[model samples]
Target chain A: MPKMPEGTVMQRLAQLLFFSALMVFAGYFSDSPAYQLLESGQTELKLVVRHSGNIIGECRALDTGEIAALAPNMRRPMVCPREKAPMRVELDLNNKREFTETITPSGLHDDGVLALFRKFTLDSGDLILHLRITENPDAGGLPRDYEKQFQVDAHSTLIVEYTDSGFSSWQPQHSPRPRL
Target chain B: MKVEAFLDRFFPAGSNPLYQLGAVSFFLFWIIAVTGLYLFIFFETSITGAYQSVESITHEQFYIGGIMRSLHRYASALLALSVTIHLIKELGMKRFQGPRWFSWVSGVPLIWLLFASSLGGYWLVWDEKAQYIALTTAALFDYLPIVVEPMAFGFLDGTTVSDRFFSLLIFLHVGLPLALLLGMFIHIQRISNSSTFPARGLALSLLGAMVVLSVVKPALSLGPADLNRPVQTVQVDWFYMNVFPLISETGAGAAWVILLGITIALLLVPLIFRGVPKPIAIVDPDYCNGCSWCFADCPYDAIYMKPHEKLANHLQSVVVADKCVGCGICAGACPTATPFKSVNNAYSGINLADENNAAILVRTQEQIRQHPQADKHVLVVGCAHGPQIDQLASDVVTPLTLECVGQLPPSYLDYLCRKEGVDSVLLTGCAPGNCFHRLGVELQEARLAHEREPHLRFKDVHVKVTTLWAGAGGETTVARAVAQLQQDERIADAKDA
Candidate 1:
């Protein structure tokens, strides 16, 4: 059996070291924002309002955009003059349970608009949104439609779900009594 | 009894352990290469990161990365085994004597390269063993006058040596394997025809073993490499790292000198040791028929087909001289008793009469076509790939015949190229792994590509040289392959054209 040259072993040892270093460098260089995002556990969420009914007002958890619970018999009312078009709202959330929602509405106005009231509840780690829309027959317009259920949490924050379809618009009706 | 007849009686087709072993080794190398590539991606070369990275890959990516690494390592080890076995089989059989001395001499370097490539791969892990290897290896280099300065200063001045030394080592790790690939090319260059794929069992077993090992062990790192901390105990790969301790104890400088001397001595063995020149195997053009069985059978890939337009046989016949490794596989494969005598017939007393008589029986055109013993009508004509042949034969009730497609006599080939009832004459020879025979399947294809010969001009001949792996008992595989080729209208058209 022929033996390998002595230098061959040394050369091989050197090669091994070199390749290991190169791989390390490659791994280190692969640090990008996208990679960081995945590593840090950041997620995105979209909220969409349904067109079936008017959305008077909504609240959400400041953190994680989750809906917060509402007090029993208490409601936040929002006014909508017309319901021909849709409305979109964007919100941001943090780790804390606090959240805020911003809504942008654009459409034609109708006299007989529906009033929307929504409440959020959180129980057993589940967020449930309760919605009540009131339509006025005294007005000349047709009755409002309530197509899908709205979800909320314990904090009574309105939960909006986003889909590929555009946001659903809502019209609110004026109530005779206002809680000051 | 004629020499050919005697050889035929004993060494018939599918015999020759050396040839079988050579085929086995070729496949093993491929297994090593593929696994090595997968491991290379995740390997970290730095002393600090190497072990950690390996650990992460093995623990976290065990299903993919870790398994691949283990397979690579196991395949590498197996490659060493196959190469060593091939070498021993050659020597014990006395196939390395005479004109084959160059190949024999070159074999030493090939082994050296394999070890070097394997060892380099081990060091990339940068584990405790890797560190020990690094330090001990530096010690060995300290012996060489050329490398002494770097070695001596490398230890004393950590920063100067560590980075540069490591960099140099990295260069070698990548470069050495490339060099080994070149050496492999050169090693088989002298042989007229040789195969890269080993026998079916050997190739599949090697691949299967690698897969199994990867799944079982899944290579992992030992620990983060620390230059300061001494690795008291390290797992040693004795195959390549055995000489490290020798250098550590004997002083690096001394070890280098001694090792250099030994290498020079081994390289010069063929020159120093004299032996009478042995006659290599010769080809007889008259009976050759250009079937290229010898070309396919040659373990060294030494036999080639040279164009001869005027001979009794048209097209090219097997020409053996320069590339002939004297393994006599061509003699064994020649359907016609064309390889009259062993190349070293003068020294070995090979009987040509016996060889010729045996050739007359099996080499005849009638026997080649009408032999009832031929179980499989589907002749897998390709470069002699032991593994593929074994795989194809094991599954189907067909006698899987392999021959250098290049040696297919244009006349008989024209007949078989389009003949009916021959399910599919799948020409399975060298493509990516070209045979030692200069004219492998590609060359034969090239000849057929321009204009189909008159005999093959008929439409039924379904000839195809595939690159897919063919294993034993892979009938569904063979059937699928045949079906696929049969579906190819172009192949049919080409045969008819």
Candidate 2:
């Protein structure tokens, strides 16, 4: 047989080596984090809501350390004081709705609007709140209105009613409104 | 005229032994597959589990699983070796040129598949090498697009990427082998009468070798893979991984592209060059005996026994041209030497000068005889077998003394045909199962059909020119065979003749 062309064997050998290395690397060293998360059980969830063109009213339980709200302008911040007892925030979106339960804290904590939003697990939906304003009629008025509903689908939001006192027919601010 | 010559060239009358080797190698692949499937059921594809599974086969399941693994590995290595050798032999013999080019072209992808399959086999271990390989592959993919989940803080959730990484590896391990099997099938479609199985002895011997090797140097994993530790050095199978170092230099994608380009070029080589018209062996109507040696001996199912209408002397004869690789085993099988000469039989009846014919034939034969002192020069005089004569001459140092100025050989002539300094012999006899000596030719043909060489057949070496004829009564048959042999200018005229 003709002497194999010069370097032909070597070239073939090199190719085999390269591909083999690639396969090996792909199999063993693939360090994807998603898998690690699934393995480690250290899952963290973060939620951010911004309203561009509307007035919004929102309430949150600051004690639970759940949600955080960031206003377009950082100058005004509201912290919802921890309630004496565990409280729930019900959100109604489009038509469907869900509620989040939060516990009150013992020590003094940030009562800002941002802190209150973080306290509860608000299901994605619209917000229709019925609350008993304890201190002021319009004190740190309800959280700004967001066009988009929190619930996964439209017409869904939180509908809150203050149960401390007999149910009152308070005009709904329809804060955190569903946006297109 | 060019078209006719082209048609006649590729469709030459004879069989190629390389084609036979390819056939046998194909069967070997199937053997590998059946065995591989058995092993795959037991194999653990995971990094941590793979090595242990393989070890279990060797330690616990030695009788069945171990044997299967050994067979699979051996078959893989053998398949690669056989294909490479087949390619080299064809190239050296210049058989890859002409109509046989597509086979050569398709061969490149086949080589790639072999490598892919072998590499995937490596990963099944998930050893240190596998770990290193995994990291390297991930790095390669990192260069591609990385989609961002704005809700998430990081550019990539490392966890997601890692999950995909494992999925991809698993997919390749399972999928590539199937593809390789498909490629093997396509590689042999063009050639006829190719053997799918190696000789039983040869198969057994190959399996034996694999067993010995596996026992002596069992495939071992290089410890558990550590992502933090860099693999500085590792034992590499040069046959499969010679290009790894190049990857370090040129970068992976560039190396990959260059290698792919080279493979494509190698595969398409047959289309890049041309060769002499494929010579077809033709038979003289008068000399045939209706015997059937060529039909039995033809490696490529090129020859067939057909009833003779014109000649009363012969009952049935072999007819083949398009499927022939012109190996000439058929011509060598002819008893009456009815199919004489390598070129068109019509070329012999052109009535060239008598003295010229004598001088050329005698001179060519004499040169062959004299060349024994330098190196065994064997003059294989035949018509349809001419191309093979050229092939043998180019490969073996022996001078091929040809004689187109001739007739088919009788039984006595077969015994008389001999050359000095010849280490081996080859004759392109007429198509198998169709000779004149009432089985005499077939018997002689049997002697030439041994499978002595793994990459070559003795039948291929000893050939017959089963198509070209020298006309009636065998008067000018010898002269025509002699004339066909003289086409090679390398032969010097003998002073005595």
* Best candidate (score: DockQ): 2
Model 1, range B1-497, lDDT digits (tens) per residue? 12212222222123222345566666666666776677567755664455566676777777887777776666565566557666654554344455566777777887778877777766776665665666566555533433313232332212323434455666787788788888877777665546566555435544654575557445555554444333445555554565666665556666667777876765665566545553356655444466555555455555567764446545454544554534343443444422223442112111122233233223433434664444334545433432244444422223334334444433334344344234445645432222333344334454445342212333334443333323222335455665575466346567889
Give the runs in model 1 whose Cα sits over 4 Å from its true position. Answer: A1-180, B1-19, B44-47, B155-170, B253-265, B268-274, B280-497
What DockQ do the predictions score, one after another? 0.00, 0.02
Q: After superposition, how far is residue A81 of candidate 2 from its true place, in Å?
A: 48
Please give the C-alpha DockQ score of model 2. Answer: 0.02
Worst 10 residues of 1 chain B by lDDT: B344-353
Best by the lDDT measure: 1
The digit string of per-residue lDDT tens for model 2 on A51-160 reads 11111235543433222344346323345434322223333334454334332222233121211221122333344332222222133334312223222222112222
In candidate 2, stretches whose alpha carbon ends up further than 4 angstroms from where it belongs are: A1-180, B1-31, B45-79, B135-175, B199-201, B226-232, B281-298, B302-444, B447-497
What's each prediction's TM-score?
A: 0.44, 0.46
Predicted model with the maximum TM-score: 2
True lDDT of residue A4, candidate 1:
27
Native interface contacts retained, candidate 1:
0.00
